[model samples]
Target: MSEANTALSDERIKNTSRLRTALIRPELGGICGTIIVFALFLIFAGDSGMFNSQGVMNWSIVSAQFMIIAVGACMLMIAGEFDLSVGSMIGFAGMMIAIFTVTLEWPVWQAILVTFALCIAIGALSGYIVVRTGLPSFIVTLAFLFILRGFTIYLPQLIERRTIIGGIDDAAEGDWLAGLFGGKIFGGLFQWLGDNGIIATFERGTRAGDPVVDGIPMLIVWAIGLVIVGHFILVRTRFGNWIFAAGGDAQAARYTGVPVNRVKILMFMFTAFCATVFATCQVMEFGSAGADRGLLKEFEAIIAVVIGGALLTGGYGSVIGAALGALIFGVVQQGLFFAGVESSLFRVFLGLILLFAVILNTYIRRLITGER
Candidate 1:
């Protein structure tokens, strides 16, 4: 073959191989387990309305939100680092927005802007401490978590000016924000779901074309937008190449001119910003915020990331896949309610998923490294 033809053939081969990796089913264990989840929910719980179109509609966006955070966590994990304080940070962000608005009587716009700044700063600060001190991110974030948790406890008393901040006099003010984040999609037939739709939405009670939604949950949109950005960064940009290189082999990447430290710091900061985005959504939706808002969400994000197939040691996984992992988690949680199983059983299932995902991640890492 001529030179051009040979080059074209080589490119085709590489594209085909990568596509196979991206599109193939995950390990037999995970694919089978996921299949079982779908089957069991369908078989045993179908009668309970979980199988209906409206029920499935109810779960999709929330699942998408979880997937978003899982994408960020997956990025961090791929870079061979971790942070455990995101949950508390979300609570902090929610409380911060509420305190600025409900307590200080700040305008909604001002409060939102300030809260956004705080979250980004906090995330960067955490990243800085982790990098500068050489302490493990796990330990550092744990310390941060405790500190933030304590602050959340104090927030209500301060905001309420009496050990509680309630009687907001309006959830409407924040509705715009909520709808932007956690709004509903089609309820019944239009959605290609199982049945007709009717839900006495907690927010509007009854409204045609409204989806009768609640909350200014911009977090959901924020998460999706971030995922798109992340996808671009991961797959379509030079930064993505460095990310893979840094995570896959930091020392080598550095020797080859990657700015290793800067990328790590950026990753850490980005994760923190995600926590903030979620927190903002919660405050808009709940119309109230407390220090306890994000008590365990960070841990859940980590679990979602791992389950999505990101390797703990770095240099493996996809943003979309990790997001899917989060969906799996949210589905199971919602599924439990439909199944009427105890809440504790859901946690048990989460643990099992984590265990299996970790084992598989390790195996995938082995496969990739052997080739390297």
Candidate 2:
């Protein structure tokens, strides 16, 4: 009887240990939070068809837009930095693309290539300044934020006397490079579904044969591709290790032979590259750019990263978690409309979620690290 009791006790101890380990995973908090938000929205918004094909596509598309920058922001945060200028960078890039292609009549591809190169240079410059000055990134990026935002507004007005730039769609017409970046894929599958009644079609309209659900948007494809690549780099590559080490302890990382400064500079450039990609996608989809485009996006990207279980101080995070965080934002942002809540109230919801997520994440980190 004593032997049997002892065996049962040992099994219980092993089970408890396994449960604790699972609970302490960095992404577990994000996963649970996403599920809860999804469930709540589903219960309240089911009749609004948020789970339907069209609704799914709508939210997923918006989420992809957020995820691209959020992934970059997550990586940067992991390496102990911030870029408040990302939102302005988007606006600037969009405007540059428009001016290059429309006002100057440069080829769309050339304009795009030039814009990307310039963006990288800007990022590298910012990183260099931060490293050389030993200044906090918040202050440095804040300055760039205003500078870039001012340029985005002033440059267009000075040249064209207006804040909006158009004609991109016309320039992209028949351009294979533009099509590659902005074009949709899997037309046959959607067409077949629409034809065979597997997917819904427009009812009683001139476009009656068109499928309500077309091919997946390019933005979503890019988001997923980047997320996978980011996850791989973070989890399975040497650079990822360098990123964590740099953020965790810059001095120690340098002492240990890591190129901390180079890693950070590259991360900064990568973040800028992501912002440009987002700008490219939006400009392509809408066929225009505006000075006010991408406003406040920097905060949203950071919020997504924080909600993804990445610490603000750096050194701990997961790209998959950031993706999930974007998903939660998408669900809430769209779900609120479906649930008939006022759009203005969404900020309140975000504030509350961010607060709670920070608290939960902090507690979980402590548990995992065995800190009081």
Candidate 3:
């Protein structure tokens, strides 16, 4: 009888272990949502060009850009903060870079360095204000959002006498720094494939008759690399534990010597840095800057992080989930176009998805905590 009881106990333990493993994965919600969304889109738009190489490239590029910002936003949310100024920061950074290079006639590399330094300073200031004043980050960053946006518009008009800042292409022409940030890689593989007739050539192929692979865009590379690094930092480091503790309970974490204030402030800085990276990539790709760039991107980043299963109250989230959420956004945005849906209706879709994700995340949390 004792031997039989032991065997039953072992079986129950094994089952519980599997259940706990499944429950602990914060990205599970994102993975499931991604699969469902992808399947739905595939079903409705399979006959269209949605699955084609060019179509995939289009959506993936947008998704990569969203993920670039969303990753940092997720980290900040996990640290119990928000940055409404991220979108404005993108515009501000791009404008700064363009003004530095084109108006001031500075080298591209020098302009880049100066722009990055200013971005860090702005981030530190924002963080410092929040930490020192004990004000909510939401309030502090909201103020910055307006300040940066106004400056982004007013600065160019003040100096260049116009809202649009152009001439970046001319300034960056033949510059190696521009090439490093804007150029593509893997041209040889695609060229070889095109030559070998392994891939279909466009009706109007290049003079070299190569396929239009266009290689891999630099933005996509940055998104993937940043996501990997962010994931590692969140899951494999002691600082990650501090972040969770800080967000979970600031008082308790501080009592335990977690340096909660420092962690939160650093998170704010990281958020700004990510915004700057996004701005840099866009400026390099378009070779221009304007005050209107990156509008409403802050909401989009927050939505992605929320859909990735991060709690609004803080402390539970996954970087991988945020990346998948970005992927979902990209798919839906591109799929709507392929399906002949009106682009203006995209906001409605986002609202619905955000609502559903919040509800789903809450339910998952209850299950994990065994809450009634």
TM-scores, all candidates, are 0.81, 0.94, 0.93
Ranking by TM-score: 2, 3, 1
Q: Which prediction has more favorable lDDT, 1 or 3?
A: 3
The local distance difference test score of model 1 is 0.70
Supply candidate 3's per-residue lDDT for 240: 93
- Per-prediction count of colliding residue pairs? 7, 0, 0
Select the stronger candidate by TM-score from 1 and 2. 2
Please give, for residues 228-306, the per-residue lDDT of candidate 2 as tens digits: 9999999899999999998988999999999999999999999999999999888988898899998999999999998
Worst 10 residues of 1 by lDDT: 191-200
Runs in model 2 lying further than 4 Å from the true structure:
1-16
lDDT of 1 by residue, 98-160 (tens): 777777877766777788787777767887887789787889888888887778778677647
Pairs that collide, model 3:
none
- Residue 161 Cα positional deviation in candidate 2, in Å, after optimal superposition: 1.0
Best by TM-score: 2
Per-residue lDDT of candidate 3, residues 1-372 (tens digit) = 788776655544435576666866789878988999899989999889778767777899999999999998999999998999999999999999999998999999889878988987898899899988999999999999999999999999999999888888788888877776677888788778777876545667355576757578888988998899999999999999988888888889988899988899899889988998899889998989999998999999999999998988888899999999999998999899998999989889999999999998888788777798
Best by lDDT: 2
